[model samples]
Target: MKLVNIHTLIFILLFIIIGLNTAQAQVWSLQQCIDTAQVHNKNLQMNRNNISIGEQKEKEAKANLIPKITVNADYKYFSNLPYQLMPLSTFNPTAPVGQYKEAQFGVPHNINANLQLSMSLYNPQVYGAIQTTKIASELTELQYLKTEEQIFFEISNLYYNAQILHNQLAFIDSNLINAERLLKNMQLLNEQLLAKGTDVSKVKLQIAQLTNQKESISSKYEQVLNALKFAMGVSIEQKTQIDPNIQFKRANEYTSSTILDIRIIKTQNRLLSSELSTLNKSRFFPSLNIIGIYGTTGFGYDKQPNDFLKFFPIGFAGIQLSYPLFNGTVTQRKINQKQFELQNSELQFGLLTEQNNMQVENAKLQRMVAKKAVETTTEQIELAKTIYEQTVLQQKQGTASLTDVLLADNALREAQQTYLSAVIDYLKADLELKKLTGNISTTK
Candidate 1:
């Protein structure tokens, strides 16, 4: 019974260890990586923060149209009372008209308190600002979309690179296995005096070279994996594996109108044109405001001579109107400046639209070429493998030289590398086409 209990504990421990490892091993698909990056990427988060700031600015602009109320208080101390001069003849009718009297009045302390309210009734600038802020908020949202598209492209590119590295490593591993087998056979032949020592040495050198290439590819694979993780906003300490299922196909065509960069510039141009219109309208319009105030004036005096404290209430309200008759043509100059800015934005929009069209065309051509290369390399790799196998058999039969086998091996490796490069190119070109069409934001 004791032995059985100990065995059961060991089994439970082993099961828990296996369970932990399985839980830690996670495979992330392309969609999963993009989604995670959208939420966690530092640059994307900063863009989101800009959106929040834009929203708050819009709220502030709207608040400017509402009434503003404030309460204020002030105190003053007078070491000597204020004096006033009066006509003395008013008190005594018989006195001369030039006679006057001087008197000291009021207390030595004073206080004032007030509550004021003011609101704009008709201010063109304020109204224009409200509209401008609304547009600015929209621009910020578009910027976030742009950032998302950029991050998606980066992640896709890195992920494609990692996949290419993985394929290369696999190729190297396969070649290493073949080279080791050939080296072992050569060693056997050399011992039996059937193969030259130089042939055995050459085979051994080939195996060593393949081993070095494998190690180098392994190191590169790890680097690419780390870069993929960084782009996905995943922790470097975590182990991650990408889903190896990738399909290559033709990308859909796109026009300049679908490009995000072009769209963004067009939106900005619209905003600038609106600003110019607002500035022109503001020059001819007037502003009106309503103001009101309610307050109390307090007076206090020391008891040594005259002990008295009094408070008097006051209130008033009125309307004010202001017009910019002329300010040395400042408004006109500002309007001119705004018009220039609008023109500049329009030019930028045009330039960007043309550039994007060029990019779309270029990417399409690249994708076509890569697709063809992939097909060609796939056939070449098969042919190379068959040639290598035949050459190895002929060498063993003493019909082919050792150099023939080496040449076949080199050709196979070259074909494999070409295929990997073609695949990477196709994936990247497809991603670029999607980006140009603004499909990256919606697609996985």
Candidate 2:
């Protein structure tokens, strides 16, 4: 039985270890990173929360049309009864017309309780507020979409940067291998006194330099990964890996008349216009409200407590009408101020449109330049590789010098690096173009 128990424990431990390894091996693709960021990013979540608040405000505006009910209760005790004046001629015929008598009346304690209900029957302001809140809600939704687009762009850029660094590291590794092979061959030649020791030393130095570059690139790759994790709202302490396969391709042309920012601004302007209109209508039109109250009043005297308290029921309902006749031209001045705001909104929209056009044009030009650079560098790398290979063969045949081989190798490395840079630039420019044209959100 003890042996069986030990075996079971071992199996459990093995299972747990395997599970941890699997968890740590999880990899995220570009799409997954963007999707995760949309859900987990703090700023996006806050913007979504604002949409919820806007929805609540809309509900509140609708609720204003419903009746409101309230209950109130009060208790009062008068140490001294209130006084009243009456003409004295009622009791005495000889009393002068101006003569009067003073007397105190009413109970020493009183209690009142009431329930009141009120509702707006006809208020233009309330209607206008409903419209305004609806537009505001739409604006919140647009804001969230805008934030989502921004996150997508940011994640794409970070992913591209990481892939570029990975490519650079691979390039360095390949060069290092070639350098080591050359160094070994030079050493063999040195043993036979056919090659100088300095040649071998130069190749060794080249290998060391490549190794240092690889280390630097590796560190940069890790930093990029950390940044990606931060953007995805993942825990920095957790081990996360991104898919290393990245491809660069030209994006389809996009032409949008309006971007997300423009839409949001227009919605804001509509809300403002609604507000101004409501203000104007309110100043000219009257508002109507219905009010009703039901309650009982109680009266009692401490000296006549045995008589008990008496209660009287009362109730009343009425409609009220209010109109703003004049307020020192305040309403007109407010309308003018709102009109100015609307004009400013329009001006801002025009300015933003011009800026967006410029961005799109600039990104297109940049992408074109980068594409050309990539093509040129790709050819350069091929030619440099051919030259390097031929130089190595000639060196073995006692024709080419060591300097020719080293220069060719360096040229090849430079070409590879230039190609990598061009690729990254093209990717960034494409992303920028997508963003400017409002295609980032729709493009996967």
Candidate 1 residue lDDT tens string, 110-178: 999999999999898888888888888888899898888888888888888877877787788899889
lDDT of 2 by residue, 1-444 (tens): 999999999999999999999998998889889888988899899998999999999999999999999998999999998999978987789999999999788888899999999999999999989999999999999999888888888899999999899889889989998899899999999999999999989999999899999999999999999999899988888797777676877556877657899999899899889999999999999999999999999998777546558999989999999999999999899999999999999999999999988888999999999989988998998998999999999998999999999998999999999999999999899888888888776667
**Count: clashes, candidate 1:** 0
Error of 1 at 107 (Å): 3.8
TM-score of each: 0.92, 0.91
C-alpha displacement of 435 in model 1, angstroms?
1.5
Pairs of residues clashing in candidate 2? none
Candidate 2: where is the Cα deviation over 4 Å? Answer: 1-25, 88-94, 99-101, 304-308, 327-333
Superposed by TM-score, candidate 2 places the C-alpha of residue 211 at a distance from the truth, in angstroms, of 2.0
